[model samples]
Target: MSVSATHAAGPPAGGPPPSGRRNYARSYWLFAAPAAVVVAAVMVFPWLFTLYMSVHDWKVSGATPFVGLANYAKMLSDDRFLWAIIRTLIFTAGAVIAPVILGVWAAVTFAGNFLGRGIARTVFVLPMMATPVAISLVWTMMFHPQLGVLNYLLSLVGLPPFGWVYDTTTVIPTLVMVETWQWTPLVMLIVLGGIASLPQDPYEAAVLDGATPWQRFWHITLPLAWPFVVVAAAIRMIDALKTFDTIYVITLGGPGTASETLNILLYQTAFAYYDLGYGSAMVVVFFVIILVITLLMLGYRQKGIVT
Candidate 1:
């Protein structure tokens, strides 16, 4: 119980020794090794292989010859690839902007006390829960020019039957509508959390000052929740850039290459045409595009957080 005696006791009963700490560290790594191996196998190796393939001429059948940027050069020259880039930008813009706007509106509407609020929110998010392929299939049926319910409704309103995905001019926009419908709820949830977390002091002050609903939202709520909106936009932008399943199921980039985004063209090149090398190059480019955009968005987010 004396100080000297206590010093000679080394440490308290449950205190770990250096040996135990070493063993704990070893056990930590031991438990982590399987996950590390799985990550390397599934992610790292495939990425390295894709990079290697991108510099080669591999068609999965014949010789895999190293061509070194030839595939990239070819992509630059291919008009279809150029068009795919344009269409991807267009689709991504529509998909992201529409969802952000709609989601913000929905969040603001749902943030109030209302009857059946729970049920209404549940119904609103149903599209987000549905499988993309299944939704695409159902939408395909509804998009039918003649027999579809959409066209039938149009007829009842005295509007003519219109091509949804069947026309090249409308395909990308149509797909964007699908993307917006499915993803707006996710954005709403994110913004709603932000809105919920906002301090009520500003709103109360604004109300006391005789501020209108639009003025309160414009001057206070939107500014406070802007970061959350930006986060939602970044997520939506990334997802929109890589959309494939819905596009494949709905249009298959059809009516020409009008609906062909980078993802669709890459799939066609790699799987459909069996041009693995070319597809690898496209993947590399697509990854770079995503990386740059993500970095910019994240930087903006950090700035917002800091400010």
Candidate 2:
């Protein structure tokens, strides 16, 4: 007995028969529909609603009237909002720079053969595992003006007892210190991975030429490891910009709103003051800022890679 012409052709070249393909596609869509719906519900709807709210006069109890760009315009002349942007930028800079510098140094040091290296690295990275809220609480106690161990240590060095987070001038630096201590290990790990993957030929050549340690680092390790540094900086920048748990737990934007970054201000506006429209406007701006920064960093990284 011979098979029919259509049956001899078998399935299509790429996959199953037409009907089977249709069934497979149906199954694929069925499996993906729940995730798509979830994303639409959780992300898409919220973002769209926020954008909608941003162009309206949306209060918790009052009528939500569409007001065009009035909410966004309000941010332009708002002193507190402008100051919040400045503070946030400053904090992000400190957070990114301090960690990158210290982390690179730590990576360089730990990359060499040393006794108890594993234990030391573990101790350094322990802070990264700690919860921000818990770390903030512990740091808060240590930041006390008079009774804090930090102040006592300063006194032992014949230095004046300084305010850690209380004074406006010192508050940002104090927060940055906390951020640096907790996150430097992350940068170290990233850079160390990069360093580990680096070619040894350049270092060998430099050593033969009698290059100093500093020269070798500057001429070789730094250029090769820069891309990793950029990545670490980008992560830290985003994290610092949106840092809330630690800042909220510690200062709550206190000392006359001296520590009020955009996140803190946004929280107060939306939840505390119930001004949803203005808060939404702030959110849009905040998102744009983050997006721009991220793009710039990625562009730089891409450029570096290409070169």
Candidate 3:
């Protein structure tokens, strides 16, 4: 049919001609509307409210007056806030570093064929399956000053029972151990997938050249697995930075803010102390820190993928 004749013909015999634009528009809305509504309800509204609260002096009982950036400025002179930042930094670094190393090792070990390997892998990942609150409750018992199983074990070895969460110095480290034990499996799973998908040619060639397992791992495995490591590291850092449930359930930002991160601080400010404006300010600052860290990690991720 000629193009002009087809156009002039207009509608089809049975029904109106298909309107691609209209159909696409309808489909787009159909697919996107629910997700868009969800985002607006769950994410956008909360964020906007937080921003509004951050600008106003909103107490639990008092009248809310717009105070601009005063709440944010207050963060600078707040020593506890400064301490919270340092604590969070320490926690994040330790959590990310330990898990990535152990996870890489675990991934390599589990990648090998052995008896009951599948069952072992399942057992190893059990910690990752447990809810953070459940894990914290269990660990809190384990960390008891004298009554805990950990202390009992120490007694058998002629060692004193040291306070885990109760002590300020050991609180963060204890938390890190808990965090690492739970999340290491996740990193292992991610890296294991990457390891499984790796090309065998390089390893085979390296073996033919009489390369030892250690040498092969150092030269071939690590370089090939770098991208996956970056991904795992970035994810772990982000998760660790926002750690709240564990801290809340275990110590409640106790041992005198020893283990309090930005998340905990924000919580305390908002709910515990009822300083909504200051809490919102802390939330915004906390988000900025996370955003910056994530951006840097993504930059490294891009470089790793490219190289």
Q: For model 2, how does the per-residue alpha-carbon lDDT over 52-73 read when each residue is reduced to its tens digit?
A: 9999999999699999999999
TM-score of 2: 0.94
Q: Which ten residues in a row have the lowest lDDT in candidate 3?
A: 13-22
Residue 125 accuracy (lDDT) in model 3: 99
**For residues 1-307, what per-residue lDDT tens digits would candidate 1 score against the true structure?**
8999987878778786767688999999999999999999999999999999999999979899999999999987899999899899999999999999999999999999899999999999999999999999999999999888999999999999888898888888889999999999999999999999999999999999999999999999999999999999999999999899999999888978888889999999999999999999999999999999999999999999898
RMSD of 1: 3.0
Each candidate: what lDDT? 0.94, 0.94, 0.94
lDDT of 3: 0.94
Q: Output the TM-score of candidate 3.
A: 0.92
lDDT of 1 at 162: 89
